[model samples]
Target: MQRTILIVEDEDILREIMKDYLLNAGYRVLEAADGKEALARFEEEEIQLIILDIMLPELDGWTVCRRIRKKSNVPIIMLTARVDEDDTILGFELGADDYVTKPYSPAILLARAKRLIESRYSTQENHPYEDTLLSRSVHVHIPSRTVTVCGEAISLTHTEFEILTYLMQNQGIIISREQLITKIWGYEFAGDDRTVNSHIRNLRHKLGKCATCIVTVVRAGYKFEEQI
Candidate 1:
């Protein structure tokens, strides 16, 4: 089935441009001129992902994003004109999976969209760790892409879960950030060590303090400590 993408942008020109490009890329596209309409369409249609603009009528992107998170985990890529770091950080905190600044390259946006969809919806039946032994306290269910710690389900973002699973599968081996970026993000993350750090921080926070599974190696990378 062809994936459907809902684009929420106030700018008519940019919205049409994205629709054209995404349609050419073989994705079914839906367009909304404001957050209100976007939310309505989101409820009415089966959208696989969203490309949302921060500025909109009736409601802003942050609120829209928050509302969406309450009901769904569909991947969101936010479009912002502000260059402020705080804005970007707030977007992520508000549940945006990624961000693209204004005047962005169409090719880059397309690539990012494709990557997010592929990563988010990819079937995990081929995961090598499916048959591996895991403690009842620490469950790594590949098919569901979920981990339960001590019978409590831990919610992890796509990137965070992938990173944790990879580390656990290769326990005791120090894996570099570059290797992680390539394997997890599906691209070479140049000069972007912070991306890896941010995901690790979020992963750790979600895993709670008691789960000391990820060990950091100074001047190197990270490794997963074997469960005792």
Candidate 2:
């Protein structure tokens, strides 16, 4: 089935434009003019993702986001007209999966929606039912995209989780920094190799005693091995 996406915006033109783009991209699109309708549709549909505008009628997007987050982890990309950095930070703090500033291209919005949805769900498809990876005190559930160290669950952002999964899946292989950047962020990924290094560092830190499983190579990128 095509993924269903909810477009919540008070502006008729923007909502219609977004709906058209998602439909053309082969997603099943749902539209709402305000937070009230948006929540109703959210409860009534199996929406895979959401494109929510900050300013809305009847109810506001921030409240809607907070409410939605209380119940689900469905990917949401916030749309804001203001360029204020605080708004962007607040959106993420409220558990928005991503965000875009106003006057953004519908095509770019569609691309981001696609990436977030895929990143949130597609990781499960690459693993077998019993494909749990183990090294020392660390246990990774590939099918579930879950990681545990010493019987405790660890929270990871989508990017961090993806990098760790990719590294572990390619265990012992010398994955270059460039290769990691491309794999996680795509060819259009703008950040330098240092971005990959930062995420790798974060992953290791979160891995606690099992941090040694991921080894950094001087000229090479990085590798994951029980022997590391």
Candidate 3:
């Protein structure tokens, strides 16, 4: 089945370019010129992914993302032209699965979109960690893709969940930022270390008391150690 992607960009030329690439990549494409129209299309279609631009009219991308996250966990990749690192962090905080800045290669954007969509809809029956990963009070059920701390469920964005799972899967081993970028966002990831840091910060916050399980190694990377 051809996956459907909604492109919410206010720029007509850029939107058409993205739509063309997605169509050629064998995906069904939907388009909206503004945030409000984006929301309407979202409500009307079975959108598998969203490529949203920040500077939209009628409503901003941040507002649209926050609203959609309330109802669905569908993958969303935010598009921005700003160089501010805070914008990237804000996107993650608003439940965005990926971020692409302006002047980006449409092919790279498509790759990111594909990665998120596939990861979300993967049907692999035999995962390496079929059982639950219990480290101290943090419980990660691989099959169900659910995380619970002290038996209390906590919400995690897709990227945050992947980061924690990878860390826990290789507990006691320091995983570098490069390794994480390749594993989670693919090699096409054009962001810097701050991207990883932002996600880690958010993940740790959600982990609460169990946050100590993830230890940062100065000048090295990060590792998961069982914390009691």
Candidate 4:
């Protein structure tokens, strides 16, 4: 089955370049010059992943992402021209799965798209998590990539999911920020450490009482204790 990608970029050259790359990589490509058309294409097609631009006409990427998150958790990769850290955080808050800044290599963008799509669509039967992980009042179903605390579903960003999954998988082990950046994001940089911290903070907050399960080590890293 060919996975479909929706590229919602306003730039004709960039959009077409992305389309060509993805098409050559064996994916079905959908295009939209603005957020309105993007949403329309999203509704009218079986889009598995989305490449969205922030400075779109009619509807901005933030609004489009918020709308999509209202009803769906489809993976979204934001394309931004700004290099502000706040923009990245805001993108995550808007439910974007990942992002690429302007002037990015098309090959890298395509690689990220492939990874996000694969991660989003992988099922319980294919990517088993050994077994469900339970601690105190928290329940984590790895294959399904779901988390529930006290019987209520706790929505997590894609990064949060991977962070929690990695920590829990190595329960009782101290995992460093660098390790997490490499393992989860597939890269490490000066700013990536802060990104990991931001995600951990948010993850802990979402876990509520079970937040204590993830213990922070001074000047080191974090460890997920099985019994708090």
| Number of the predicted model whose TM-score against the real structure is largest | 3
The best-first sequence of candidates by lDDT reads 3, 4, 1, 2
* Alpha-carbon RMSD, each predicted model: 2.5, 4.6, 1.8, 2.2
Query: At residue 173, what lDDT does model 2 achieve?
Result: 91
TM-score on alpha carbons, each prediction: 0.86, 0.69, 0.92, 0.89
Model 1 score (lDDT): 0.81
Off by over 4 Å in 4: 123-128, 188-191, 226-228
Backbone clash pairs for candidate 3 read none
Can you write out model 4's per-residue Cα lDDT over 1-228, one digit (the tens) per residue? 889999999999999999999999999999999999998998899888999999999999999999987777788889999999898888776777777888899988988888777776776677656758877677888766789998999888676887888888888899998898777656522246567767788788889888888899988899998462
Q: Name the lDDT value of residue 201 in candidate 1.
A: 76
Q: Distance from true position, residue 57, model 2, in Å?
A: 2.4
Mind giving the per-residue lDDT tens digits that candidate 1 earns over 113-206?
Answer: 9988887777666445564436535667766667787778777766677788788788789999888888776662222566577778777787
Per-residue error for 94 in candidate 1, Å, reads 2.8
Q: Model 2 off-target regions past 4 Å?
A: 123-138, 152-160, 163-228
Off by over 4 Å in 1: 125-136, 188-191, 226-228
lDDT of each: 0.81, 0.79, 0.90, 0.84
Give the backbone clash total of model 3: 0
152 in model 1: Cα distance from truth in Å? 1.5
For 1-228, candidate 3 gives per-residue lDDT tens digits of 789999999999999999999999999999999999999999999999999999999999999999998888788999999979889989988888899988999988988998998777776564556567778688898767789999899888788888999999899999999999999999888888988988899899999988888999998999999755
